[model samples]
Target: MKNYTTPILILFLFLVIAIIGNITISAIGLFFNHDVFNTGVYANGYEASLNIKLIFMAKAFALLMFIYSVYILIRNLKFLVRRDFFNNKLVQCFSKSGKLFFFSGIVGFLASICGILNIAIIKDFGSQAYLNIDSKSLYIMLMILGFFLLLFSKVLDKGNEIQQENDLTI
Candidate 1:
């Protein structure tokens, strides 16, 4: 397990760097692309007023949360590498990651709702707001995964206590 840790850490670091780079490039593009805010058909097959800064802000917030979750995962992996798998710090990191994931999902769901609302407001009965199934499902999945991660953290904490007792007995 120790021998595998270094390679896994390296892979995770590469993924973190890649995701950060993608986010940075996207931010730069959004900054330069004035048309991003213009009224247009979104990728979700809905027509909406895309010019609102709130839309961008929501997306940015969600992305940041995702990054934070990944960072927490990295911290958890660091504990594993250090052979501190059952430590409180590791459990805390897992808990934090779960919260971030849940929050990000909510942000994404709200952002989609905002887009639909924008369309309905601008069109004024001419257009109807439709539910975005993909976004809704993704958000639901993320929240579920986050909830399980948090539950796992509690199990880890219990395991840690048991391990400590066994160590002392030995």
Candidate 2:
């Protein structure tokens, strides 16, 4: 135990600040019809429409979920130093975070799909000011990471069972 409390707290605070900033930007972009945070301006030179709003809202929801998952994961890291690597609390933390992230990834994936389709439809008529920079790969990567976390949780759960059994026998 080399005392990771300080470093972890620092990293957590930094992440919280970044998440807050991102959420604020998303909110501003949503209310002001701005093209910030990958809202993606359309052929009309702005994101001032119902479809754009819906897509932006979906992305915002996903962003919140993703941030929350990370927060939970980081907040429950005390088990690392406590030598309680196979605890229920840690497993639940990972499991819940993994599920939330996976759901968020799905939502983001759908939003990206809708955005691409919208772009395709608009571009069919003409390609005059359409600028879409939304990365579909990002959502896919999130999904993968969430799945890994879920598997990690399962492994930890099994380890917990083994540790409990060993303790009982001793």
Task: Tell me the whole-model lDDT of each prediction, alpha carbons only.
Answer: 0.66, 0.72
Task: Give the CA lDDT, 0 to 100, for residue 130 in model 2.
Answer: 23
TM-score of 1: 0.66
What TM-score do all the candidates reach, one by one?
0.66, 0.77
Considering every candidate listed, which one attains the maximal lDDT?
2
After superposing all C-alphas onto the true structure, candidate 2 shows an RMSD in angstroms of 4.3
Tens digits of per-residue lDDT for model 2, 2-108: 37777877887786676666656655665665555442453266545567667767876787788789889877877877777888999999999989888989998
- Where does model 2 exceed 4 Å of error? 1-5, 33-47, 123-134
Output the lDDT of residue 157, model 1: 92
lDDT tens digits by residue: candidate 1, 35-92:
2433333434543234444565575577577767876786567688777879999899
TM-score winner: 2
